[model samples]
Target: MLSSTPLRWPGQARASVAMAFDLDGPTGAAMLDGSLWGKPEYFTFGGYGPYRALPRLLDMLEAHRTPATFFVPAWVVETWPRQCQAIVERGHEVAYHGYQHESFFTLTLAQQRAVMERSAAIFKRHLGLVASGFRTPSGDWHADTPALLLDCGVTYSSSMRGDDRPYFIDAGDASRRLVEIPGRWELDDYASLAYTRAPDYPAGLDRIASYDQTLDNWCREFDGTYREGLCMTTLLHPKISGKPGRIGVLEEFLVHMHSHADVWFATCNDIARFWAQEYADD
Candidate 1:
């Protein structure tokens, strides 16, 4: 049988909230397949994230005084250097996603290492960022992914859906482990908000959910997680949640979170560091 232990957050806070965004931009399999060669429309759709939505989202986060984490693909960072820098300038964190949202499950150990190395170098060159955190771009990882990430100097990840609290994944070494700040599908905006007409993408255009219900669901999840004193991290996407029509959903959710007392709003890096330090023995 399994048991649950509530984590005591910093400052005796009831719960911890890490607002994370997967800044994927326009890089994906489309780039690999040559299908996105002339689709300015597709490019525009994804470009909306860094070009327009990011500024609004940044301002909104500033208004709430909340720190966030952006898991960016290296390609996106290279393409939108200024916007990516703005995230750091606004007191947020920039973590690694992948080179071009590649699936680690498809890459060999060597390929994975190369990807991390190239991505890390790109981040360093473009933004002077040494990313300590990672979120798997494809929502899954290779069997040896954890070890490779540690080798690349990544200390934590905001992937996986195993638990609501932070845990450690064995990094193939007894002396060190990578911290995992897990997220859930219920907390991801892509699952509820993204829509595409492409037949190959999502198979249909039925992805969008009711905004009011989605907001309610987010609040309810927060309430339950807060009640249990567990960590809550969102798998949000700027392209999905930053739309003018949907930004209010994020705002209302933030307002609801602020209404509760003793809730710690932090970046994923801070939460992971705290967990790793406070629960070093675990």
Candidate 2:
């Protein structure tokens, strides 16, 4: 059975839904190096040997004239500072990812705070703009997540999974400095191919229908609550979404979003700032 449905995005205002491309390039390299942290490490799910897919992804975004936010690791900035700086200079946004790409959930509260503080300082020092957003290394955030993020003064974090809409995640605390923006869930290509054993992974373009269905799902969710002005986010890792063959799938989706009125293509910072002003209530 085939079902056709309209696609709606967060805030589905006549305004627009933002398209975010997370540039996770060089750090993928560090992860490839087996990382100083240890084994069972993940550089990429598709296997990361000699296939530098990220540059191609960047080229694709450039071709689309699509601006993105590169949530970069501090180590990457320390190593490839010029490239990180270049991203911002060329109009893309830069946000703090992590210093060592370590999972926040693995760290103690003190360790997490130090990680945030050090990474924020490095991002500001190297790039001139303090990272306004934070993404956990593996989408793994720990129990004290809300307090840690708030204490560090981060504006919004894209690590949560319940919904795609952006919302003021009240930590139910005094330092409520954080907002939780929803991100792609098991929907990521890697999760499907490896974790879920989805057959589409090997079929490539044949999986377009599944991709389309995902987008359709987003639309239905957004349209249902258009008046609520929700925050929606999609996740992309260069290794996963950057394949020459797969990038087009994403590109097609971008075109689809633009063709429809009311979808906004924006940076993470832009979306968060807008949400703060128009969507959030004190």
Candidate 3:
């Protein structure tokens, strides 16, 4: 039954997980001091606060020869088009992170569609890539988002916080274009940030989990997916993962990934395109 999943790569391809970065700049750090979901200082300060470690991050990833996808907000791209271009120029995939970084759950359906359209336009005109993927700001999406995303020409959305495996979403009639690449709540940097501990090293908690017990769950899911032929994904934020102190945990995890040969470390777009081609009739 598992091997029946057309999404699964051929052979023993253990779940090929893509590493991603939200790439919100220092402006988000400043916003931390402001009101966010009734919490002040939410993302206002930290390792990712916009000192622009992209160069360092690039160096680090280069050291490992790793390719990643960067989900960039339209405002961030407008703020740093050069940097955004550099990300593409350096070979990492770019996906939409909304226009304003506002949660879709908070917006009216029209507002959500407006933002989605704006985001797609920005990516296409500026980065010269037609971003077929979407990730909600704060990972919040209403049930109506899929329909609106289809209306906006989005082929897949990555805000799902459940199983790691990707699956086709029946958009009913609004649009059959949308697919779901399940995101994990346990593995995202945001989860670790909110995960309370006395020590409260929000950054370390996520990095630590990447290599520690948290990863066990990811592997279990990966093994299950590969054995049964499923799919999976992991999400990261540059503010958290790109930091020097925390990058070690991510580095360790990548090294661990290297041990597995069958896994396909591919871009989110690659997954979406392949699925559409292979299962369009299904």
lDDT top scorer? 1
Where does model 1 exceed 4 Å of error? none
Instruction: List model 3 lDDT by residue over 177-280, tens digit each.
Output: 57777677555656543332322435455334434554555455556655654555667776765667666666766776766777777778777776677666
Q: In candidate 1, how many Å is residue 186 off?
A: 0.9
lDDT of 1 by residue, 238-260 (tens): 88899898999999999999998
- Candidate 1 C-alpha error for residue 235, in Å: 0.9
Clashes of 1: 0
Candidate 2 per-residue lDDT, tens place, 1-282, comes to 001233333465444354554555435333635542342334333233113554565566677777777777787677666666767776877777777677777678888888888888888788887777888876777767777777787888877786655666767654464666667653354543222122233345443345565555545544543434444566666566666666666677566555556656678778788767754444
Worst 10 residues of 2 by lDDT: 192-201
Off by over 4 Å in 3: 1-7, 10-12, 26-51, 193-229
**Clash count (model 2, backbone only):** 9
Error of 2 at 44 (Å): 9.8
The window of 10 residues in a row where model 1 has the poorest summed lDDT is: 196-205
Q: Candidate 1 vs candidate 2: which has greater lDDT? A: 1
